[model samples]
Target: MHLVHLTASTLFGGPERQMLGLAEHLPGEYRSSFLTFRENGRCQAFLDEVRQRGFAGEKLRADFPKVRSVLRELTDRLAAMRADVLLTHSYKPNILGRVAARRLGIPVVAVSRGWTWENWKVRQYERLDRLNLRYLDRVVAVSEGQAQKVLAAGVPADRVSVIHNGSRVADFQTPDPGFDTKLHSFFPADTSVSHVVLSAGRLSPEKGFDVLIEAAVHVLRRCPTTGFVHFGEGVERERLEAIIRERGLTGRFVLKGFTTDLDRFLPWSDLVVLPSHTEGLPNVALEASAAGVAVVATAVGGTPEVIADGETGRLVPPGQPEQLADGIAALLADDRTRMAMGRAGRLRMQSRFTFAAQAAAYQKLFASLGSPTVFLQERVTCQQPPSPPSPEDRNAPTRPGRFGSPTSSTT
Candidate 1:
C-alpha cells in the first residue's frame, strides 16, 4: 500500500516525529510518502528530514486561500503516485485533503489532534476543521479524550478510532558521553546548578510556559539550586521572557529555543515537566517516560492516560502555578521517591507505548480501508459505490452539544 501523509508543517516537532516514526516502523509492504504545504519556507526542515529518511516528500507550490490551485495540484500528485489512502494532520490539510481525495476516489482519513485555540484566527480555522470532520471517510483521534471531541463534532461513532502516540524508546536508551559538557554550556560558567527541570514544546499560549515561569519562582525558594530550562520556540517567547524578568528568575529560568537533539538531553534531567493547557497525548510525556525521568504535568487531554499520579509522576491542575510548584518542589526534595517513580515510568512506557503496538493499530486501520489495487481497480472500472450522504447534505444540525455534553473533567 502507498500511504500519502498530507500536512502543513511549519517545523519538525512532535507531530513530525510521530509521522516519521510510523513510517519507519511500518512493514515493508507499506510505502509511506509525505506532502507538505510550503509555509513560506518553513516547511523545508520537515521535508529535508523526510528525504534524509529515504521517503518521498514534496512541498506544494500553492498555499491556503488559493483553494482551487491547491486542489488542482493535489489531484495531479495523488493521481500520479496512485496513492491508496491519504492521511491528513492539522486543519489546513484536513479541509483541503478531503476534497482532493474525493476527486481521486481515494479514502481520506484525518488525524484529529486537540485544538490549541491560541488566537482569534486559529480558533476560526479550528471551527472550520470541526465542520470538515463529518465528511471524511474516517477520523483517527490521538486519544480517547479527543475521540469524544470528534464525535461531538457530528462524526458518527462508527467512523472514529483512537490511536495513542507511541514513544521511540530505543532513541533514549544510549547515553551521550558529552551530555554533561553540553548541559554546562547552557548556563553561566560561575553558576553552580545542582538539579535541572526540563520542559519542551512550542512556546505558545496553550503550552502554558508563562505558568511554568511562575511556578519556577516558588520552586526556587524551596530548592535554590534547582534550575529550569525550556526547549522549543514560538510566539510566546517574549511574554515568557517578560514573566521571567518580573519574577527575578534571570539565569535561573532559561528558554533554550528549539532543538532537534532533545533526546540527547532528556535523560540527563532530574524531572520532565509539561505545563500545557491542552494536548493530544503529548509526545514529551512519552519520551520522558522512555528516558526514565518522572514528569509533572497538568491533568489535561490524554496526559493522565500517560502519567499515573503519585506513581509515574505528579498531576496538577492547569494554570495553577502554586500547585505546580508544590509538585515540583516535593519531588525535588525526595530523591529516593523521585528515582523510584522514574523507574516505574520507564516500565510503563515499555509496556504500553511502543511503536510496534502503534504500527499494529495503524495497520488494522489501513486494512479496513481496503487494498490499493482494489481501490484503483474500482476507480478505473467505475464500479465504486456511491458514498452515503453527510450530515451537511441532509441539513442536519451539528452544533456543539448535538451528540453529547462535553466532559468537564480533564482525566
Candidate 2:
C-alpha cells in the first residue's frame, strides 16, 4: 500500500523516532514515504540510520504559511504517488494531512503522542484541529492515557486506537568498558559522574524540568557526590540554566543540549530519569531500559506501561519535587537495586519492544485502513493474511505464508 507520513516538527522527538523505526522496517512494495515541514530535522540521524538498513524514501519541504499552496502541493504529490493512506504525527501535520486526505479521498490516521493539552501551544493547535477529526479515518494514540486525553479534548473515543510504540530489540547491546568514560569527556569533569543521573528530552516546562532541578537539589543534599545531566534542547534551556544558577547548582548539573549519538550518552550514566509531565509510551525510557540504565520517572502517560515500579524502574508523581528526589536518591544510594532493575528493564525491552513488533502494529492499522500493498509479514501468518478477511472478515481465517499468497499456510 502507498502511504504518506507527515509531521511539521522537523525535530525528531519520541514520536518521530518511533515513526522512523516503523518506516525503516515496513514491508517492501508498501511504498511508504515522509513529508517533513522543515527541510532539516532532529530525526535525520535516525532516518539516515534507517536508510542504512535499506529503505528508500522521499522528503518534502512545507516551510510556508500558505496553506492553500501547501495543500495543493501535498495533494498533488500524494496523487502522483497514488498514496492510499496519509499518516501524520503531531498537530500541524494532523491538521493538514487530515484535510488534504479527505479532499484526495485517501485515508488518514492522526497520532496523539503525548500530553496533548497542557502547554500554551494548545490553543494554537486546537484552532487548527477544528473538524479535522471528521476527515481522519482513525486517530491513533501511542498509549491509552494519550488516547483518553485526546477524547477528553473532544475527539470521539470510538475513532481512536491505542498502539504503544516499540523499541528495536537489536538496539540493545553490551557496552564496551571505556565507552561511558569516552562519552563523559563531552561534558565537564564535574558533570561526568562519581554517581551519574541522566535525563533526556527537550528541556521544557511540560517536561517538568524545574521539578527535576528541585529533585536534584534534594538528591544532592544527601549525596553530595551525585550529579545530574540532562540531554536535549528546547524553548526552556535559558530558563532552566538560570534556575540552575539561581539554585547554586552550576557544578552539580550539566545541560548537554541535543546529541545525535544517543548510544554514546547512555553508557556513561548509572540511572536515567524523565520528569516529564506527559508522554506517549516514551522512547527515552525504553532506550534507557534497553541500555541497562535503571530508570526513575514520573508516573504519567504511558510511563507505567514500561516502568514496572520497583521491578524495572521507579516512578514518582509529576511535579512533586520531594517524591521525584526520593525516587532518584533511592536508586542512586543502592547499586544492587539499580543494577537489578536495569537488568530487568533490558530483558523486558528485548522481549516485547522489538522494532518488528512495532512495525507489525502499524502494518495492521494500515491494512485495516485499506492501504494498497502489504509487504509486512505479520508475526502470525501462513502466506498472505487471507486477503485481510474483507475488513474484520473474522469468519474467514487468515491464510498466510510468503506475505502476499492467498492460500499459503498462515504462519
**lDDT of each model, Cα atoms only?**
0.86, 0.71
TM-score of each: 0.91, 0.83
* Candidate with maximal lDDT: 1
Evaluate model 1: give its TM-score: 0.91
Write the residue-wise lDDT of candidate 2 on 1-411 in tens digits.
Answer: 776788765455666667777777778867767766754564465456546655544555554577888788788878887777888876678887765666656777887676445457765676566345534657776666565555545454445666667765565565665766755554466453578888888776788889999888899888888878888987888989999999989877888878766765786688998998888778898889888888999989878888889999899889999999899888889999999999899888877677776677677777665433331222124332122112232232322121111110110
Q: Flag regions of model 1 displaced more than 4 Å.
A: 371-411
Task: Name the weakest run of 10 consecutive residues (lDDT summed) in model 2.
Answer: 402-411
Task: Score candidate 1 by lDDT.
Answer: 0.86
